[model samples]
Target chain A: MNAILSDYFLPCLWASLASAGFGLIFNIHGRGLTICAFGAGLGWLVYLLALDAWGQDIFAAFLAAIVCGFYSEIMARLRRCPVTGYLLVALLPLVPGAGVYYAMQYCVQGENERFLTTLLHTFGMAAALSVGAMLVTSVLRALLPKFHRAIH
Target chain B: MNDDKLLALGAELGRRLMSSGAEIYRVEESVIRLLRAYGAEPQVFAVPSCLFISLSAPDEPAVMRMCRIPAHGTDIELLEQCNCLCRELCRNPIPVEEAFEQVTHLEDRCRKHNPAVVLFGYWMTTAFFALFFGGTLPDCLSAGLCGLAVGLCALFGTRITGSNIFFRTTVHAALVSAFAFLLLRAGVAQNLEAVTIGSLMVLVPGVALTNAMREIMAGDIFSGLNRTAEVILVATAIALGTALPLILGQYI
Candidate 1:
């Protein structure tokens, strides 16, 4: 894990910085910085883990979103701030900008299967991440609205 | 002077007003208005409250809390008497000012590094170098540098360009293809992969990946998935562009 973290040094550094920038806009306070940064770091980890799990350079991206949401709530409550700061930062890693582009290139070249599979996977991963965040938040709200409300 | 304090003040306000019965949208608008009143151009979106982020100046401030604040009065009162509410609500105007100043300072920094120059310059240069000298460097260094260039450009591109997915991907891919083609003509003493590595740098959507994860965590599957596709597309485009020239090289 350390090795993988150390490997993509620049991406990690920039992503962290970007997360910090995000923190400022959303008015993330106290632990919000930590929460935001964790999301960013872990988001990158999604790609690394996906590569290890699937043996391809993919981002299993759902985890990145889910983790970001879970942490955003946890951190927001802890810090008594909003979740926007952390969520945006955490989201830095799973944008699928590269995936969508490649899929198009493949399609343009008439490589249908590669395009379809890659495109589907990217979209699926994104869908999973988004749904996960909503589920966690709704569950959190249902399970402990009082605790969650205290943060804001 | 610091960004944290302003954010803290805003957060405190958010926390304090949660019990006052304001919808999240009202609070968001109020906050954005406050930021704007102070001359900071904070972007305030009314989408998922979970994603309420601002790109006002140099730094993007994030929303940390999720509590709802009650509007002080009805629409008739608020719309008719904003000045009264403004004075009544703001306890610590200093924090708002400080935050505005900090963001303005940041906005200045962003303006200094024009996206057109940075994106275009890096795109052309990375490709030119990869084509001319790709064989001379180590594989890791080549890929790393290329990645650095593209990653950096994404930051500016996100800000300068319109917020459209298709536009962003198309520009990124087209640039990568242009650079890859240039490298092909240079005929450097490198294999296809090495050259590909160089051009591939401009296409990594590192930010998108992180954002997707964040959305998922925020529990917005539709948004999270949409974003993931965008980031992945960028990477694929870079790879394909560099590879295309190689395959065609055999014929040429």
Candidate 2:
């Protein structure tokens, strides 16, 4: 119970609150706000679990982003809103903020090797996130017409 | 209404969606869809900074409208409302005059969240991010305080006329990092990196980068490139801004 609390539950809760807060800043209100928060929390949870299992940050981010993308598309369909309304905020926790800061810091200090390494890592993580999300969304979009026809 | 008025109305809707930070393709699609549903075939092109639309019908001459969209903050509520309006228009077509009224009303009252709620959001976002990044309790508290400063800067930054994007972002980031460094020096915060990064989340261009990738994937290469450039510029500004203060603090 304690392990679950410390490792999984608490972090997911914080991630949800943080994403929801950002949703508010972007003027997402009411039920949309709650749904965004829940999706963000789920994304973070998936990210943490993936990291623990795979021990690769980029892979974890990629997997988590896939989940987020799928969730956003499904929710957008159900809620009758745009996918971006959910995807943007839910993907915030994995944005590589620290990497950007450290890369810049290294660049300023004239540590070219470290700066290059950090910059590449940050960009790679971002690419992974985008690619993962794009994979799901593109596939879904391609299949959407058939899916709609079937439903009708 | 005449074709000219309808064209203008369509362009205005496109303008609102673009200014609210909707994707270029989404704006173009919405505008084209809305116009087609109302019995006009329209050609629409949209980018981050401008929109071009031309409308024509069986018996009417082509009517064109061009609008230059100013940069604005992202407001998901407005985007959702606009999307809903589009869906409604498609299903149950409204009169052109009534559609104009709806679009104008949305334009006027698009921003829904109040100042206080927005400030609280900033605070909570920073605080919880600190926690998410493995900060201790004190770290979260200090980050929250820093977030208050960031919130204030964002609130007042928009009011300052002639303040360009690069200058505003650089200043805001520099100040936030400098304040974080001071708290560290004063022994008030244990983890400087966590606190600074948490507070800095507010300035990161996550939305721009994500949208850029999506646009590219969706094959809107022009808009994807435009948004990618924007993300790079904003990221560089933030990195430069945060680095300056850290370098200065190191010297001290």
Candidate 3:
């Protein structure tokens, strides 16, 4: 556990700080960074948790969608550029491009079940990330009126 | 003063931009305009930043950006004059990041990247492949990763190359596709995860999303489209490049 924590823990923290710093340097400010960092860290941590609990690659594509939701809403208020940047970067880890590719590979190889699973996961992750981003943006907008002007 | 230092400083400024929650587009344009004033267009690969205006030559054929006094703090009017200089620069045809003191404007933004953010992407791709097609790929059919890696490399290459974005995206995907295929023939399975992540990292519509939201809020679809289309194309190239080898395997 120490080894695992050592390996994952520091990096996750750095990811938070670095991504936070990136947000700050980019002109993101106030509770906006706080919110963005929380979401970014949550995404990183949730993935770590999923990795540990399930081992390797189980339900990650789907859960990553959840993180994207959180990331988009929080970043939308703070960064204020548009939905694409945060939505894309936030969903970076979850994009199922390879999943779709492998599904095709499996289809060619005659594995129907495997192909379907891969296909479902890819679409599921994509849908989830996009919708999640939209949904989160709406929620953050509605709930957090304070960050409105900050929205670029 | 060194070009490398300015570049590094530019990167750090990018990190600060990220941290500040500033519109990376606004910051990048501001920086680009300022650098162009001094006659240097920075070639920094700021995806988060590039999500706004593209890293392309302006239609005006002149550079644009503002600059303030170095040692003395700048007043708002000085900024206006700097903006004036940037307007003129944008009107002239000068190389972007090399026309002036590149780092002086936005030297506060760069920071380290999370390797996990990098690794997770590649790992996600690799695992997705294995989960579905592990049996088909011999004991170690790592070549799929090479294909993905080249896809990403192409995206990064597009940014710095002085070509039009569509051309840059296509060239990047094509070059990386060829590289991935060659690596496979050589039996060298370089971390397909890293390559795919790095290259794809370049094309992700980060700027589009940012600009899309900003434009819509400001009620400017025309400006947003200018940003969005490039992002979508880059993504298309990535998807096509990554899938090419997998698709071709059927015919071969």
Candidate 4:
């Protein structure tokens, strides 16, 4: 239990808090900021779980981004705000920042082979994240009004 | 109210949404909805840097308003406020004068986060990011310190009049990576890559990239391409800036 807490739960909590901090930088306020943080945390948790299960980093990113996008859409509908507010901060944790850094480092050192590999991987992961979010958002956009009518 | 005043109000609302980092489609939709509520037919074209809105009521000529939006930082609170205001306008159409007054008040009432809070936010972002990237305790501490420096740079970078973004980004990235390099050299951090990456995460253009993808998928090809260029430019600036110090340190 302690190990699980330290390994998974704590990291997820930290991810949430970190996302909240990011929201603060963009001047998010009130309960909205908290929801954004929670969405990030949930997405990170899903990413970690998928990574462990599938051992594919790109797939993990895609799955996590889908979760984040769905969360953002639901929250936007509930709160009546633009989806960008929640989606932007919630997707922060999954961004391939380290990959970009390493790719550039390899390029600068003239390690062409490693640089190409890392750069390709970084772009692949970014594309996966974007595609995941896009799919979910577009689906929601198409179906939401129908869902609303059914509910009413 | 006159069509001119209604047109101006719609344009102003669109401008505010764009400046606050609302997506292009959202801004365009809101303007159209607001103008329609006011019994006017509306047409809107919005990109990241500018917005144009034209409104016409029956028996009156269309009046167009175009504004060059100044580059501004994202403020989600203000975006939410504006979104709420537009929804209210659409559901319960208000007089043009009252709508204009509310928009002006919202513009004035937009709040900026306190400097100290922003600095703390930066620190938390890096420290947690270090942990998320599998950094140890010392690595997280070092990244947090570097984050404070990056935060200070960002706070002051905005104050300098006419500072080019590329130059500011490059300088800030170099400074943070150099600081991380020093920490590694002094044996204060176990992993230089983790520390540097964690600190660099704050500067990544994640939001821009996400928005770009969404725009393209939504078939706003021109705006999407423009945003994609912005994301690549920013990413390249950050990467180059981070690499410079590491390369120099290797020779030294």
Candidate 5:
């Protein structure tokens, strides 16, 4: 239980609060703020789980982004608003801020090889996130109506 | 059909959507759909900086309107209102005049948070991100202070940073890095990296990156590439800004 709390619950709580703060920066209000917070927590949780299973941060980010994308789409459809806010805010925790920082540090220190590696890794993480979210968005946009009609 | 009024309404809607940081596809589709509802077949082309709409009504010559969108931040509240208004207008075609008035007043109707609340948000984000990145308590506090400085600069120091996006981001990143250095030297923060990275989160171009990918996926290759270049420029600005203070700190 302690391990679960420390490794999972605590991190998710922090991610949720951080995402809530960013949501405020983006001028999200009301229930949408709460939704972004929870979605962020959920995305982080998925990332952690996928990391443990795959041992690849890029793959983990991709999976987590897919989840965030679906959550944002469903919420947007229900709320009758654009999905941009939710997806953008909720995905904040997974963005490669650390990678960008470390790359800058390495470059400043004149460690060319390390900086190059970190830069490439950062690009990979970013590309994975975008592709994951875009994949879900495109697939859902093309197929959700068909599924809805079938259900009806 | 009053071609001028219809053209005005479509152009206004597109401008509002673009200024609210809507994806290029969303802006184009919304304008096209709204004009279609009014029995006009319209063509829309949107880049990050400008939107162009052209159409010909029956018994009328082709008319076009081009609106240049200014630099904008993400305003989800305004985006939601504009989207909702567009949907309503499309579903039940309102008078072109009334729709135009509503589009123009959308900004007034939005409920923006007070400056104080936004500052609090900045503080909260940095403090929590410091903790999230495994910083100690003192580091978190220092990061919060740095966040406040950044928030102040961003909100009220527009004159200093100017309108250039790259220069503005560089100024913000430099503020965060310099504050981190000061706090570390004063022994208020334990880790320079943790505090700086925490506060630096605000300047990252995650929104532009995400929107770029979405636009690319939606087949607006040109707009996507435009935003992607922005992301690279801002990232480069951040690196330069961060390195400046740290390199100077070494000599001091």
Candidate 6:
């Protein structure tokens, strides 16, 4: 239990704080900032859980991104605002910043093989993240009107 | 209805939406909806850099307007306000003049964070991201310092960084990597990777990558390709920028 808390919960907290800070830079205010930060925490939590289950970082990112997309879409519908800000801010934690760094390090050290591997892994991570989030967005866009009609 | 003013208003609002970092479809859809609400059938096209709108009504001359949007940063508050105003206008038809004034002055009403607060935001982001990436407390502090430098450059170094987005991102990434190296050498930071990655988070093109994918999926293949190219350029610039510092550090 303690290990889970330290490993998963702590990182989620950090991700939330980081996202909130990024929200400020993006000029998000008040409740919108909170939503973005919360979404970030939620997405990171899901990512961690999925990582533990599958042991595939890209697949975990894809799962986490789908959750974030749903959260952003629901929040946008409630607030009648664009989903771009929330989605963009929340996904910051999962973006492959470290991959870019490692790739650069390897290239600088003249390790072509590792550089190519890291580069491909980074691209795969990005593609998975995009595909996951966009899948939710596209499906929701098609079905949301029916859902709204049903609710009414 | 004065067709000239109505068309101008539509074009202006669409330009504002584009400049505020709205997606391509949103800008086009919003303008078309707004014009239709005012009894005009409008056609709108928007890319990342420019917007085109052409409308023809029965009695008035066909007017087409094109506006080139300036380089912009994300301002979510402005975007929200613009979207809300557009929706309100569509719900209740308003005088084009009054609506135009409101759309132009939208930025005046929304509160803006002061520079100090934004700098603090930069510090907090890098610090927390360092911790999230498994850095120690000291490493987090150093990363925060590097973040501060990056924020300063982003906010006030436009003259030095210039207008080229690629050059600006490269400069920011290089600054972060160099700062991380110096801090590591000075014994202020233990985890070079943690500090550097945390600082580089601010420069990553995650937004563009996501936006590109969204545009393609939404059927704006042109805009999607444009943003994808931007993502690739920025990624290459980052790799080059960070590599410079590492290569130089080897000699020192």
Candidate that would win on lDDT:
5
Docking class of 4: medium
lDDT of 3: 0.45
Per-candidate DockQ vs. reference: 0.11, 0.71, 0.11, 0.68, 0.66, 0.71
Provide the overall lDDT of each model, using Cα atoms, as 2-decimal numbers.
0.49, 0.86, 0.45, 0.86, 0.91, 0.91
Classify candidate 5 by CAPRI docking class.
Answer: medium
Q: Which segments of model 4 are wrong by more than 4 Å?
A: A146-152, B57-59, B161-163
Residue-by-residue lDDT tens digits, candidate 1, B39-63: 5555544322232434335555453
Q: Which residue ranges in model 3 land beyond 4 Å of their true spot? A: A6-41, A48-88, A100-120, A146-152, B1-167, B181-198, B204-235, B243-252
Q: Determine which window of 10 residues in candidate 4 chain B has minimal summed lDDT.
A: B157-166
RMSD in Å for model 2:
2.0
lDDT tens per residue, model 4, B69-150 = 9877788988988988888888889789999999888867777789999999999999888887889999999999999998
TM-score of each: 0.47, 0.95, 0.43, 0.94, 0.97, 0.97
Q: Model 5 scores what on Cα lDDT?
A: 0.91
Q: Kindly list the interface RMSD, in angstroms, of each predicted candidate in the order they appear.
A: 11.8, 1.9, 10.6, 2.1, 2.2, 1.9
Q: How much is the lDDT of residue B173 in candidate 1?
A: 47
Best first by TM-score, ranked: 5, 6, 2, 4, 1, 3
**Model 2 per-residue lDDT at A140:** 87
Better DockQ candidate (3, 6): 6
Question: With candidate 6 superimposed using the best TM-score fit, by how many Å does residue B181's alpha carbon deviate from the native?
Answer: 0.7
lDDT by residue for model 2 (B30-123), tens = 8988888888888998878889998766776667888998878898888887887877777777888888888888856665888999999999
Tens-digit lDDT track for model 2 on A72-131? 888888877888879999899888888888898889889999999999999999999999
State the DockQ, from 0 to 1, for candidate 1: 0.11
Q: What lDDT does candidate 2 reach at residue B135?
A: 88
DockQ, candidate 2, comes to: 0.71
